[model samples]
Target: MGDIKPLEIADAVLERYRSLEIKEPDSANWTVIAGIVAEDTRSKQLRVVSVASGCKCPGAIVGKEDILKNNADIIKDSHAEVLARRGFIAAILEDKGLLRSDVRFHMFSSSPPCGDASIYEELDGSLRFTGAKLGDWRRESTEQVLGKTRTKPSRSDSIYRSASLSCTDKMIIWSLLGIQGAFIKTKITLSSLIVAAPHPKLIHSLRAALFRGILDRTHTFANEFCIPPPDLSIHVIANHYSGPAHCTKTKPSHLATAWWLSSYSSVERIVAHTGRLLGARSDSTKHSRLSTNALFELSDSQYQTRSEAKINSQYSILRRRLASRLIADFPADHPRKRRLLAHHFANNDIDESVDMRGALPLAKRSKLSPLPAYLLCSLC
Candidate 1:
């Protein structure tokens, strides 16, 4: 394992897959895809299947061109997932001395429509995937409440489930590698978690708890599943746009939420702010290089206020357009849309001086803590 590079492993796995002569089903829907597997120092095996849409092998019923046009979003998301997987694999390889410690790996594009990925060499070379499954809880809850049935789970659902399973799987892999034990032997420095899209209420609560060092105690569904390291200095890079936006478009409210979240002491910085502008349709090489450099440069500094200001300035027009569209499409009585409007307008109104007096007692119980404090305050 120490002698093998992750790219080599990926190539070997893909070659084996090619040799299998697997063909898509007679129907136009089925496909074949790439994947990888590796054994650690202790002979413990870990396999990662690319979430990328299956490649069209010759004789497949469906053509690549048709799939590309119809399922563009799926392909884009799968590619991002594959890139993240590769980065994880590279980190594992480097940890095992298979790759040079100084080698930098690029895992995510600079812009949106594609998910964000950042590999930090300083924080024990840990790789972080931000916004991995954004908007999952909302979508799942909506579907359940509406009693909508579908043949497939939503994209957010798939990403959320996959990230959780990946965490559990990685824990197993790390433990098997002799990394963790009953007592913490070596601190698992590498941390990855899905940051939900910034709803104003959610962002405000997180910011408060993060400032107080009680984020882990808040017990939200996202916090429960995407565990972070205790050190708090491990550099939590917020990976944005990790899932398909078509399922849940990046409204202005979401950007405002992210802007506010960045002000928190816990959130180190954001990656892929305007995801589409950086990577939308073209190759993301330049943007990726620039973003990777930007992340590394900001690793030691405090949160940059100018970066937020720049983001606000750049997206001002787009945000206005999104606001206008929302207002036109959803009247005041529309439950979800109206809430979106409220979030858009309330970004600057978050009361930092608001006391957390009675909140801590109820939050400790977990039952009532899942609701954001902003929402509770609004009710009060």
Candidate 2:
């Protein structure tokens, strides 16, 4: 069989988006979600999904096309960034031999979360497609992309009959099964967390866990590296689950755990991508003051429909700029503040030596700060 084309997956995801009832379905940032889907296809990364940003505007879907068109520039650029970072993440996974090129990640979110089927549903079809491709190719029954199907006599019932085909065939099949195992493992964790408290902080906690997973994949954990301390419980959970191994049994608990870990990774990555885009935009905004009216003009009605709460949530990360400004302007006698600074500096022990001898007050007194003088140095 010929290589499965990227457009096919893009088309499928786009269709799924278009078919949704704008108001009735779950709240998700469909355009951003679709863009991520399309971007992943091009990269040939297993398009594993995690929770998406859910939206709930009454008529948000009506102008989706136009909204997509308007934000296409930023969306495309953001998607590019996500794909780039994913490559770095993928390399980490590859080194550990846990990464499978054919298995994409699928994440689910709910505004709309309760009734959603388990995460296993998304990977099911893709795995089948991978299997079919291998099976046909091995049987030498593959046809031209445009050719009509023809029935052929098969001598062997065993797909494993051919060695060449078997490797790809079994790999795809088993990886998916492995993913199912992972999904189960993830689900269990998520359920327990939900039972405890479905607070917004839960999502943040989940993101940190994902960052840990990425670190693990990069072997950043194997070697001593400055990992932002994650919740001990989450760190324990994430450390134990590296996703599915081929021979792993698909215990119900396993699926729950895998899904939880993978889902957490998806949300974290998407949020990080969004933050990067917003940060880049915020920086540009600093240099050129776009009037609020002018900025409103740039926004689509869809964005306009957003509640102040929603808008604030989206821009919440921007507040770091303010916190950073505060740190830059912090007073000298603030010992507690100084401790906070210390943690930041300590984290950078993973990076290069920070030069603290600059003449600036913040620069000269790095011993009490959390951030490395280098970063604080840049902020100053």
Candidate 3:
């Protein structure tokens, strides 16, 4: 195989996008219903990627070539930014000799939530894809699965349970199984699976859930599909900007959080990648200006001329309180306890020379008190 040109790759992507179809029975009402169902399913998958990858709009998918071409301008700028970051990753992999000339790429657009798009790689006769799911975590609720009445399980749940029987008794079923048919045409073997999120703590929670799903059954999935569990690579992508330097209260970047959480996982690699920086002056609306000015004022008041010791101490106090709350919520032997403790001890050792010279004002401390536990955990 020879090197592929950009146009050729783009054409291939367009072709693949065009070939996707709603695999439902033909009927007048059924057609409409199926289309709606397919679109919703696709939207949820796209949401997973969007939240994880930090891409806002996964772009819209209309099945017409002319429409896609015409609307190409809408996504062109954002796509360029994403492509640049992905291209950098490709370059790094190639430099390390992990990528080869014959490597095939499959791009999925407007499909998954971690972002509006994703890229899959086929190299050395093996296939793999990366996915991300970011944002604040919420506990799954019974109402979400069972509906408002809670009379019975959702229709989707029944369908999924039925589908699991066709695979294997020993293989644990994954929610994503419903969409596996979309990848059938590629016919590539599994090699690696990279999952990313905005924060390392969130990634840790995600990793635990993923492993539970993967390990629930024996090697039923591997045996049935002729593919073993792929090499898992966890990552943190810094797609959002933390505010100015004097903002002692600003949360650490996703990249830094990922680094802190790296030691807890047995992942093959914990990669940190930077995306296009969001410009402060890009939005000129009054609301945007007001918010920016507010942040500046807050940083100036709380951080300017403040001794490092005072800042560290304030942060430590906040972290310890949050950690204590989380520890109380989880069981003594729970895996999350370990992560919380790791965070607590890690921050506890920071230079704590008591300095009351420039401490955060009591009023400001009271204002910060209502910060959500989830956000505080991220700070740790």
Candidate 4:
């Protein structure tokens, strides 16, 4: 991996990645588009097309005139996933010495449709489709299932002769059909939309869990199977589950039920990228550089507030939005929504000592503790 400069322009981005060379960032607000496209193009390995050792294209793969029209959304999705991936993996790679000595890891969010949906945890600690809907939830869930053929009624049918559907089996069937509609009701979380490496230790643990999935066998990131270091940060951009506008219950679950999908096909490039962003070895004499361990430590820390007045005075914008969007979204007619909203607003706006009562169920709390102040302080 080599030092990758902070990508700020489309031309620089195109020059860096051979696959995106033809995809111009100039048309449709190219500057903003460039950074996003470049980041995502790398993160998702979209730019890594298989070629012979000394291969060259005979002609253009996609035409200039219709490129954006045909691939705008595809490009956009790749970009979001890329951004999320960088946040986690960069830290990991920095520790592994696979990245360059000049580039810096960066992460940012993009505008997209937002909302909430329901989330369910199965007995085995796996996510079950309680209900979640996104852009086209209904259409996405429809599927054709093949079941065994049954014979006509007979005088002495064995217990096995008659087909049976267990309640759990039937639920699975129903879930398949209504999954789209149900998924729409759940809110989306950052982890759900993107593939990110948790801390290096977390990634190591996840590798075993994900081994049964496709990620263990194939290279999903950077087109190579590379184990990312434990310190990197990778994040993804995604939308909340879609549902009726008035519902407020789903919003809290997004925060509480945070979990990561195991199979990420995009690890190799991101690992190399993390190495690139880490830049030169940390030097105490140098200014504005933090070691890989420090970066990971800070990202795993938490924030605390002592008073409502102080919280409002300090985080005014955050407070205002929390009150309006979170609290006000609850209607007077819905008691549960109103109460939940009020509790959420208070939990965020003021520093209440940790109390077990009236808190989220123990099972649903986030796996990652709140990030430390220093990690966010620089970004903020």
| CA lDDT scores, all candidates in order | 0.24, 0.22, 0.21, 0.21
Task: State the lDDT of candidate 2 residue by residue for 272-345, as single tens digits.
Answer: 22222222442243210111122222222324443321222211222232222222322324455434533332
What's the distance in Å from true for residue 342, model 2? Answer: 25
Q: List residue ranges in candidate 4 displaced over 4 A.
A: 1-320, 323-380
Superposed by TM-score, candidate 3 places the C-alpha of residue 26 at a distance from the truth, in angstroms, of: 48
Q: lDDT: which candidate is best?
A: 1
lDDT of 4 by residue, 291-319 (tens): 22332333333224322111112232332
lDDT, candidate 3, 287-351, per-residue tens: 11111122223223433462321212333343354333322322223455335433432232111
Give the distance in Å from residue 57's predicted Cα in candidate 3 to where it truly belongs. 2.5
Query: How big is the positional error of residue 165 in model 3, measured in Å on the Cα after superposition?
Result: 25
Q: Which ranges in model 3 have alpha carbons more than 4 Å from their true place?
A: 1-54, 58-203, 210-229, 235-380
Each prediction's total of clashing residue pairs, residues at least 3 apart in sequence or on different chains, is 7, 43, 19, 44
Q: Which run of 10 residues does model 2 get worst, by summed lDDT?
A: 187-196
Decide which is better by TM-score, 1 or 4: 4
TM-score against native, each model = 0.21, 0.19, 0.22, 0.22
Candidate 1 per-residue lDDT over residues 290-334, each given as its tens digit: 122222223213236534311122122222332233222222234
Each candidate's root-mean-square deviation in Å? 22.9, 24.0, 24.9, 24.1
Tell me which of candidates 1 and 3 scores higher on TM-score. Answer: 3
User: Candidate 2 vs candidate 3: which has greater TM-score?
Assistant: 3
